[model samples]
Target: MKGAERIEIDRRYCKGCMLCQYVCKYEVFEVGQERSALDYLMPRAAKLENCRVCRLCESHCPDMALVVVAKKKGKGKE
Candidate 1:
């Protein structure tokens, strides 16, 4: 199965509730020192390789700031 290419969290809309970190089964997120536009600490997507593109973080984000980008499958590669 194709995996995640990356996860994008928009700091402008994020509130740093850390729901993304709590929802992630792979421990992909962590509390970072960076602050968002609203002056709240942001969660960092650290262990990107462990992500499965399940979109749990995306769905769980209260501010809808999280986006999980899945790897595109190659045509006829299988």
Candidate 2:
């Protein structure tokens, strides 16, 4: 949680729907100008620092295009 983790989106399955953004309370996503493999402009993760690793966006994605990675734990603190 100290650093940001990357979020992967599969454009082939994404439908350009913003439900992931709508469901994210952290405001981690934004509507992007890039077109998807589905030939539609898809939403992008514009603010990853705001993400809480809540997995809400992954669960809310209708086509399951979103994948979130949690940061790796550092040395023996856990």
Backbone clashes, each candidate: 0, 0
lDDT of 2 by residue, 1-78 (tens): 543488888988989889999999889889999888979888888999888888988998889998998777789744
All predictions: root-mean-square deviation over Cα? Answer: 1.5, 1.8
Q: Encode model 1's per-residue lDDT on 19-71: one tens digit a residue.
A: 99998889988999999999999998888889888898999888899899988
Model 2 quality (TM-score): 0.87
Question: Which residue pairs in candidate 2 collide?
Answer: none
Q: Return the TM-score for candidate 1, rounded to 2 decimals.
A: 0.88
RMSD of 1: 1.5
Backbone clashes in model 1, listed as residue pairs: none
Question: In candidate 1, residue 35 scores what lDDT?
Answer: 95
Q: What lDDT would each prediction earn against the true structure?
A: 0.89, 0.86
